[model samples]
Target: MSMQITLRRARPSDAEAFERMMNRPEVHAGLMQLPYTTADFWRARLAEPGGPAVAELHLVAEVGGEMAGSAGEDPVGPAVRRRHAMMLGISVAPEWQRRGVGSALMAALCEYADRWLGVLRLELTVYVDNAPAIALYRKYGFEHEGTHRAYALRDGVYVDAHAMARLHPNPPRPSPG
Candidate 1:
């Protein structure tokens, strides 16, 4: 059976749901974030507008009127030299996994990056063992960049991560003076 899900920009009011989603053991296990994430953290995150240049975008996935997942994009740095490059993060509920929730989020994000933001490079780091996520990223054109040993601490033990990225075919063109 297929489930319908909607994607929209995240708002401050979604802090609670975002918190709950991140607190799931399965979700946290795959991420570098520690357990016991607070709603206030998400609240503060959503409360701020991404700056004049839209250096970041946070999107929420809704399923049957419930917040099912989320995806975020931010720059690798604040300097002008790195403005065209960005980093990505995504998370989905256990129940929503393998059910198109991730695909929707990725699609929305890639569309925004390509059409709206004109980002030249989108990067992400995923656990090396996360086959599902790796495959999903590959489906969207991200290729393996490299591996980082002890890239993050999950559940109190160091783990390796694979760096992946998708370089936009048409990078943003410079404005003529």
Candidate 2:
């Protein structure tokens, strides 16, 4: 049976669940990270401040009331000129793959970036072999910027990654002083 998925901003209380989901072999492998994520790290990330001035958004996807996936978007740099672009990261549980959880998380993040935060560019990097994630980003208008060889080390082997980005079609107006 199919499960319903919902997207919401992540909370500090979700640290433990986030830690568990991210450490899974399949999910962590896709993200090119060692299985060393800690709950305290997630808690600190979730508790950080974010709003119009700084559009850091950490989002979670829930399936049947359980955390199924997570995504985050934050400025690529802190300089004034670089605030228009944001970097993205996402991960979905093994059981949640092929479902709508990833899609929902992407949609929410893009919406927040384009409509709410007025961000002009959204960027992310995915392992070259992660076809499902690459396809999902393409569906959201992200294009391949280029490839980085030996960009990440996974299980003692270097892997290539594709840089992808989406430009907002109609950005929101900046807040006036």
Candidate 3:
């Protein structure tokens, strides 16, 4: 039997499950997350205000009524010139890794960025050792631009990361006079 996956905007009510998923040993190992993330932290983050101007999107994936994964996009910075660019982050439960959960989350994020938000650039960094994640991102059109040496510390050792990005495949065209 196949699992049914659903995607929706994350809510404060999902704080507990979100925290659990992010803190899982296998899950946090691949992400930049530190151990012991609290439910309160996720609650506050999920409840943060957003609007048309904010352009922030956080989505959770559910399967069999359980949190399977989450993905999001945040503006690269506060500068007006950077409005067209957003950074992406995603995480899937260890059991859900090989499933389509990650793909579903990526599809929704890309759709929102390209169609509704008028975003032209989506970017992310992944540790070079994470081949599965790198393949997934490439499947979604992310191209590696460069590498960052000692980008972050994980397990008391510095790790390198690949800077990947995807530009809008079909940017809007201005009306002809």
Candidate 4:
């Protein structure tokens, strides 16, 4: 493994860099449901209205000691019954793709999901044509639930997404030592 890259909670300082990655054209093409968002909108989103949830975490991967990637989760719905579930979002800088960053973030999200919130399921949607991200989701044990046809319009045309979820096994406890 690449030990030089460190993964941790996204601090306020890392917000701008993370937003930059989110705004990248390839990232927008592969990951988003719409066009690039304004910096202010992204900043507010990263600020987290209340704060980080143990389960609803925002993480960044620092490589060579610089912010290189990010991942996050948020309540999937406003309804009380759906609070136990969260949505997943992950991104690694173009230069950092296929490195350990995405895996590290997924591991952290799973840990937080099971142990912190006692969540039963965690899910995400990836563009139907995004093969690499789909592979990554599968590696993390997310099963494809189904695909939504033309769920999003990209470049004035429709695109689809595959919804996937992982129902975790029992969460591991931290070592007492």
> Considering every candidate listed, which one attains the maximal lDDT?
3
Candidate 2 vs candidate 4: which has greater lDDT? 2
**Clashing residue pairs for model 3:** none
Off by over 4 Å in 2: 173-177
TM-score per candidate = 0.93, 0.92, 0.96, 0.86
lDDT of each: 0.90, 0.89, 0.93, 0.79
TM-score for candidate 4: 0.86
Q: Which ten residues in a row have the lowest lDDT in candidate 2?
A: 46-55
Q: For model 3, how does the per-residue alpha-carbon lDDT over 1-77 read when each residue is reduced to its tens digit?
A: 89999999999999999888998889988988898999999999899887767889999999999999999999999
By TM-score, who's the top model here? 3
Which is the winner by TM-score between candidate 2 and candidate 3?
3
Which scores higher on lDDT, 2 or 3?
3
By TM-score, is 1 or 2 better? 1
Q: Model 2 clash pairs?
A: none
Report, for all candidates in order, the number of backbone clashes: 0, 0, 0, 0
lDDT at position 107, candidate 4: 85
Summarize candidate 2's per-residue lDDT along 43-137 as a digit string, tens digits.
99788877657768888898888999999998998798987899999999988888888889998998888877788999999999999999999
